[model samples]
Target: MIRPGLTFKLSILLACIGVLASGATGYYTYRANRTMLVNEAGQSLLTSTELLGQRFSAAIDDVGADALVLASLPSTANVVQTDNGLGANAPREQLAQVYASFMVHHPEDLQIRLITRKHYGLELIRFDRDADGLMRVEGNSLQEKGQFAYVFDTLAFSPGRIYTSPITVNHEYGTHAAEGKPTLRLGTPIADASGTVVGVVIIDIDLAGLLNRLQSDLPSDYRFYLANEWGDFLVHPDASKTFGFDKGRRVLMQDSFSATKPLFDQATSEVLLNGLVQPGQAAGQVLAFVRRPFGSSEGSRFIVLGLARPLQDVLSGATQLGNRIIRMVLIFSVLALFLAILFARALTKPLHILAYAATHLFAEHAMETLPLKRTDEIGILARCFDRLRREIKSQMDVLHNKQRELVHLATHDGLTGLPNRMLFMQKIEAAIAEATRREEGLAVLFVDLDRFKQINDQFGHSIGDKVLAAVAHRLTQVLCSADVAARLGGDEFIVLIEGPRSAEAAPGIASRIIGALNEELLIDGHSMTVGASIGISQFPDDGATAEELLLNADAAMYAAKSDGRCAYLRYRDVIEARKLKREQASEGATEGREAEPTA
Candidate 1:
């Protein structure tokens, strides 16, 4: 049997590797795109649900406002308190007409009534909207509603306070179009002139109609859900699932969506669930739910509103992307196979040369021997390698530059771009060592801004930061080339001045700094004046070490503030004051000893 040559073996190996790589890349890209789309869809659904919940709450508020308007009217209270006699007929008729006009405008309101606390919650004036149109219930047609919770519970509420009832199926007799429909009731109490609870103005809302109005603009693919505080479904995509408690079975929202249980426990105000990790019916959907306050009632009442869209629809773009990726992967695999065969034939001598050059890539003139003159695949590969080597060198240069920048940043303040406290200390230590060797005088100035806190509190921190930056610029302008300045925390700066006349020149430098800061600053169209108190300390005379000099200068700075700010003090004065106080105390002790009895 004849065996394959080296070129054939190499071609087969390279082709297999390319095909595997292309397939893996295609799968990873499809999966990543699909995940991103799913997450975005979940967030979008959540926002829609929140918007729906807000709309529902606003609708309830609107109904309450309308009820308050009616309850405040003179005719409603007049009709409620007066007996159903000839004297009350005109006001009752007027109130009935008002209710009719309101019902005509708000078709979602099934019924509006003036129900009294007396006569077993008698319906004084009632208007019901049915299939035909608005109908006014009169005389015996008006029914007593005191036995109903919407009437009795609402009567107990304080005057002007609105009440909202739980959503339930309306089984009341003679409710016309509202009979047997899901209803929500809103009521506000009416008080007489003496503040007596006379009656209530109640508006019964068709729950389905209200939700339909709220979701009218939503897309057709979106499904809506609503649940009471007890987690019972009030509205659902599937009609059979809604009002399950009324049907003697429980199809609770928490039971349907396990993640939504937190909403019932008040643990979370909203929930987002996706089909990827969920099971059963939720396995191919993205759903979001938000809890909304039902009304301004005294009790803690709330309802959950939700929206859902199919995950398949959300990932449709990702699916198309996956199809394109698959086609590209097939095309690349065939191209890779053809190139592998071509490379197997031409790779022999150049491959050895390229391998040797790669090993010594950084060596001097390693690419000088490449076959760059030939216009074939080997020459193209050599040129590509040269370009890659240049790019690698360029990247190394960029990395080195970044490292130098990081070092500078480590030593400088981010806000003022001046040396920070640590860097200042390092600079001072070096200056102290040089001064000690050369016997040169060095001065340390501790500068503190006057009334900076007041400026910060009045103008805010943004302006204060700008002031600090300007102050730093002024300090740099005022100092000599050899001198160093640094920020030592908030509103405090330290400066190092060296040379022969450092001690004598320290005060002049301090005066110049104070003058620079004292000038009025025109920041953000606000003219403000600032000043500085500086304390000067000299090397060898004040203290030998950097820390000792800084401490002395800080003490002197406090002295300047105590003596009235906007001035400079020297550490020598502080030391003399201490010496004078000690001498005075010693003299007083000697006088006391001489004047005492012998003992």
Candidate 2:
């Protein structure tokens, strides 16, 4: 037999082994898949960045050339000439037409603006076309053109330079908007034949439009943003319209551009001219970045274009794969548990069968030896059980006989073989319930042999017991089929008579009991005569509960002794009244004794 403790330990060890094996396999599979996914995503991001950079550079070059052409037209001498030459009465109307025409021609360029340097201000010219297909320019004054004083001052100092440069400038055109819209202004210096800088030609493209184009080419889950040297957002695809120059208005560079910022800043510092750098310092940080120095070739303004991809994304993919693997493992675990339980049951089947057979062997008292057919461990157990069965059977026979003797002793008197007090009480309680249900009367008779103590004192207790047994036999013989008789120890006995109609009927059963006791009893080779006084009480009318009825019957038995020695009496209200009077008399006597206790 396997010990219960050992079986439990083995089952737990097996389950743990299964879980550990599944978990380890799941983790490794998840990690491998995740690494591959992140690599793919990084490669795709780098490819898209290259494509977007080419498109953005091309658009910037086109806008720069267009701004230079419009700035040299001599029509921009004043707001009125700029407006009339562009064929619009208002500067804003002329500029709006110029911009509208530009948007129509270059539909991919979402916004186009021409900025001029005059009186330390930027005049915003937009291209518009009339019904005649004639191109017009509208000049709009920038309110915060003072903020861009550095741009004009730098261009004025070196007018010989006329290559593309990236400048971080603040907008002043729209007063209804916020104070400053920071932008990456791509410009080239416009100079005279003598190589003296007259003014800078600026193309004020929408920074957000450029970023939107860049981000749209990337994956849906990834974030893309562009920030200038000051760590301010030139363009943020998520919250684009709110980009500006106030400290509070600056975009959170640490949030959207966090993963790529260090690499971008490093690239900005390294390449004073156009060049490429690795994504990070480590071998794992090998993302490609291209830096194009912005502003004129000989100018103060320089801007770097940064592109990066992190291996952390690969790690994230691996984590997701690990979760999936865990789910699969959990599914397999449930299957394993079910199969393990089935296998365990199969292994324990013989034991279960043996247990059932053992239970039946004891219950049915089978005398045959255990049937051990095989030579396995189970057969050895069966052989052991068979030996155990024979030993138990031998003891069982002795126990059965002893038990029978005890049952007889419990329910019958040792001397009389009549029902004892315990059995009598059980029968009486049952009779009371039956009588109440039938609305009939049950009579409880408390019978005491009269002058029985005289017999015991004159003769020995052996003779006394003989007399008592003879009386018990006589009572049982006289009892009706619906009646019970029991000895209450010594010379006292009780009888329960059910199906009686009234208390009046109780006297007849009691009288029969007394008359039977009056007959001569042969005990110890002598004929002796004894009388019995039986007191009877009826159910429901005499007492509601069992204890009360038995108590009343006992009191009536004493009353029978007081009335005379050898008759029976039925319990009545007078008996209870007499008991009450005796109690009162006893109380009065107690009080009088207390008062007179001085001596």
State every prediction's TM-score relative to the real structure.
0.50, 0.39
Query: Once superposed on the true structure, which residue ranges of model 1 sit more than 4 Å away at CA?
Result: 1-26, 85-88, 297-299, 324-599
CA shift of 471, model 2, Å: 1.9
lDDT, candidate 1, 1-599, per-residue tens: 44454557577776677657857688678778877888899899899988888888888888888999999997777778885622347777777788888899998899999888888888888888788998878788878888888888888889878888888899889999998899989999999988888999999998899999999999999999999999999999899999988889989999989789989999999988888757464878988899888675454678998889988898887776689787876687676768777765666677777787899887656788776665666677888998888888889889999998998899998889999998999999998999999999899999999989999999999999999998999999999989999999899999999889798899999999999999999999989987999999999899999999999999999989888889999999978888999999999999999889864
lDDT string for model 2 (18-115, tens) is 66686668756765575466556556655655566566665565665665564454433334123222333565455455556655665333234444
List CA RMSD, all candidates: 21.5, 20.7
| TM-score of candidate 2 against the unseen true structure | 0.39
Q: Largest lDDT belongs to which candidate? A: 1
Candidate 1 residue-wise lDDT at 584: 100
Error of 1 at 350 (Å): 53
Q: Model 1 lDDT vs. the true structure?
A: 0.87
